[model samples]
Target: MRWILLAISLLPHSLFAEVADVDLNEVSEQQNAMKINKCCEDNELMVDSVCRLVEQYNQSAWIPKFKTEDGKDTKVKHYRFINGIPRCETTQQRPIFDLGKSEDQLNMLSDGRLLHLIHHKHSTEDIKEDLSNNIYSIHENIALPEEREPASYIYEQDKYCMDKILLSNSNITGVYALICVPEVKINWRDTDFILKKILNPLFHAIAMVLFLLEAIIYFVLPTLRDLAGNIITTISVCLIVSQAADLVRIFTEFSNHVSFMITDIILYISLLGAFFWLNSFGFYIWKTFKSRNVFLRVTDVRKYCYYSAVVWSTVIMMAALAICAHFLLDTGTNPNRKMRSHFSSSIIDNDIEQETIGWLGIAIFFTPIAFTIIFNVFFYVTTLKVIKRINIYGRIHYKLKGCFDLFLQLSLIMTIAWLFLLLSWLNFDGLIYAHIVVNLLQAILVFYVCVVRQSHVTFLLRKSCCYAEPVPTGEWGDEMTHMNGGNY
Candidate 1:
C-alpha cells in the first residue's frame, strides 16, 4: 500500500498542474513553427544543398588555377567545365604520342569513351600502361582505378589496330586528353588560306615583276638617270631582292638548317633596306625643297654618296645585331643543333624555340624600320609645307606639281601599309587581310605613279630605239629655281 501511494505521488504533479487557464494561441504558435526561406543570387544556383556559382560564372572568373606537384599554384591558360568540374586544357610538356603522327587516329565515341587506333607493335597492356602512366604524370589530380581495363578492338586488314586501346574515364574529356595536339591545319577552302597563301603569293609575284620593269626604266633610261632616279632605282633594287628572298622562303623547302637561316637573314636585311632607302628618299625630297640651289647639281653626287654610306652602314649594323641576338640572346643551347633536330624530326618544342629566335630577329629588324617610317612622315609633312608655299606663290610648274602629288600619294600608301603590317604582327586578325591587300596594291600604285603617269617616262618608252626629240627640262629646272629662292 506504501509503494502504490509513492507511485501516485510521483505522477500527480503534471496531471494536477494543467487544470489552470490554458492559452490556445500559444499552443497553436508552438505547433506551427516559423521556417527560414533560402535564396540564391543571379549567378548562384543551389548545388548539393549549397549556393554555388554556375558553370559560366566560374569559367569567366579570371584564369583557372591548379596546384602543381611542388604545392605551388600554377596558372592554366585555358580550361573547360565538364560535369560541373573544371579541367585544364594545357599542352603537356612531354606528350605520350606524336601528335603530328597520330593525326585522325584519336576519336571520341558517343558514350564518352576514347578510341585510339595506333600502329605500334606493342602489346595492348603495355600501351595502356604507358598511356596511363604518362597521363598521371601530366595531370596529378586525375585518379584512375587499378582494376580498370580498357576495351580493345582488332582491325585485321590494316594491322593499325594492334593496340586499339579504348580509354574510359569520367574525368578525361576529349579536350583534356588531346590538349597536346597542335591547332588544326588551315582549311584549303577557307578564306584566310585562299587570301594569305594563294592570292598573297600570286600578287607578290606580280608586284615583283612590275617592280623589275620599273627598276629597268629608272636605271636604263638616260633621261631618268638623275640623282632622284638613282635613289628610286636603289629602292626598287632593295624591294626586288626582298621579294625574291620571300618567294624562295615560300616556295622552296630548305633541307639544310644553315640555308634556311641565311635565307631568313637575307630577307630581313633586304626588307629593312627597302624602308631605309625610302626614308632616305623622303629626306632627299625635303632637303631638295629646302636647298638654296636650283636643280640637283653635280655637287649633289657627293651628298648621294654620303647617303648611301650611312644607309648601307646602318643596315649592316642592324643585320649584325639581329644575328647576335638570334644566336647569343636566344636559348643558351646550340641553335644550329636544335634547328637541325627540328628540321629532321619536326619536334614541337624545338619548333617553338626556332619561332622564338625568328621573332627576336623580327623585333630587332622592325625597330629601326618603324623609326624610319616615323621620320619619313616628318619629312613628308615638311616637304608638303614647302610645296604649298611654292604653290601659293605660283612658282610650281604643272608637271612638277603633278610629280609631287604622286610622290606624296606613294609615300602615304607605304606608310599606311607598314602600319598595318605592324598591326598584323601584333595579332590583329582583321588587320592581316588589310595588310596583305595594301602591300599588294602598293607595287601597282608605285608603277602607275612613277612610270605610266609620268609624262617623261612615257616619252622615253615611246622613243625607245629612235633618237627622240629633246625632252623639256624647264619644268624640273623651274621647280628647283623656286625651291632655291630664285625666279620660277
Candidate 2:
C-alpha cells in the first residue's frame, strides 16, 4: 500500500519526464539540418538524418569516431558540419537548416547559395512556461509550415535543414539533447509485488507441504503405499533451491550490487540442485523397472549417477563463470572507437577458440539443453509406443515417470525462451514480453504441479511394481521379454 501510494505521488513527474523526451526529439529535429556522416557512405543525406534523429530519440550512447590519418576526433567538431554534404559522385544537395545565426549578411556563397544558421537561447523560465501552457500537446508548436513567402521561406528552410536538432553548440556535434530522468515509482498494487515475491515461494511451498504430507503417510498411513513420496521429496528440494535462487535474483536487482562471483556461485548451486534432482527422478524410474531381487543394487547405482551429475554440474558451473568472465573482460576493456570492430572480430575469433578450450563449458551449458529437447521428443515417442504395449500398471508408471514432469516441461519451455533471448540479446526485440511470458508460465506450471500431487497414486503403484520384479542384481530388467511374466 505504501509503495502504491508512493508511485501515485510520483505519477505527475513521470508523465512530465515522458513529455520532456518528446519535446527533446522535436527540438532536435528542428536543429539538425543535414545528415551524412563517415559512418555511412552511399546512403542518402535524409537517411543519415533520419538515422540520427531516431538514434537520438532512442538514447544511443555517443560513439567516438577518430581520424587515424589526421590524429583528430572528427566526430565532435567537423562531422556535424560535413554530415549533410553529398558525395562527390552524387548530384543530390542536402537541405541545410539555418539557425538564424546572422541576419545582416545574407548573400550567396562560393557554392552559389547562402545559408544562415539559427541559434536560440533557451531559459528555464521559458521551458516552465511552455510546460505550464501545455505546448507539448499542440501539434504546430514546433512543426514547420508547408508554405511560406520567398525570403521568409528561405529563412525557415535554412533554419532547419535536417529533421530535428534539439541542441547544438561549438563543442556538441549533431543534435545533443537532455532528457529529464524520471523518478523511480514502484507500485505494490499496480506492479505485482505480491506476484513477484510470492509466486516462486508458492511453488516451493506446495512442494514442501506435499513432501511433508508424503513423509507423514510413510509413517502413519499403512496403505498409502507409493514412490510418489520419494519423487515429491526430490522435486520439493529442487523447487526450494529454485525459489532460493529467485529470491537472490530479486535481491540483486533491487539491493546494492554484489560481485559477479557471488551471483555465479548462487546460480551454480541452484542449477546444480535442479539438474541433479531431475536426474535423480530419472534414476528412480530406472530403479523401478529393475528386477525385485536386484532393486537394492540398481537403486544404489542410480543414486551414484544422480550424485555424480550434481558434482559435475557444480564443476561446470565454475567453468561457465570463467567463460562468461572471459567474454565480459574482452568486451569491457576497449574504448568506444574500437568497440564495433573489436566485438565483430571477437565473435569470429572466439567462436573458433572457445569451441576447443571452452568445450567443457559449452557442453555443460548445452548438453542438458540439447538433451532436453531430445528427451522430450523421446518421451513423447516412447510414451506413445509404450502406451500400446503396456498394461495398466505400466501405463501408470509411464504417466508418472518424472515426479515433476509438468514443472520440468515448464522449465524446459523457459529454457527455450531463455535460449532465444540469449541469441537475440545483441538486438533484442520484445524482450520484456518474452520475459513476462516465460516467468508467468513457469510460475503457473510449477504451482499447478505442486498443488495437484495431494491425491496422485500413479507414482505409488510404479514403486510397488519396481520392487516386485525378479532377476540377478547386475542383469536386472535386461530383457523386456521377461516382462510378460506379470512380475511388474
The number of the candidate with the highest lDDT is 1
For 343-389, candidate 1 gives per-residue lDDT tens digits of 11122222221222356777899899889878977987887887777
Model 1: colliding residue pairs? none
Residue 346, candidate 2: C-alpha displacement in angstroms: 30
Quote each prediction's TM-score. Answer: 0.53, 0.37
Residue-by-residue lDDT tens digits, candidate 2, 1-488: 99999999999999999999999987787565333232222222222223343353443333323232222323333223323322322111222322222111122222212223222233444434533432111111222333432231122212222222222212222321111111223454643434434443454455445444434443333232234444444444554554455445433222223332344355444554554445444444434444343225435346555655664576466556656654543331211111111111111111111011122333454456455445545445544454355465543353344333543564464456446534533423345334434544554554455434423333333334565523222222211223444234
Give the residue spans of candidate 1 off by over 4 A: 1-193, 252-258, 295-301, 331-357, 391-403, 426-431, 465-488
Global local distance difference test of model 2: 0.37
Candidate with maximal TM-score: 1
lDDT of each: 0.54, 0.37
lDDT at residue 459 of model 1 (Cα atoms): 59
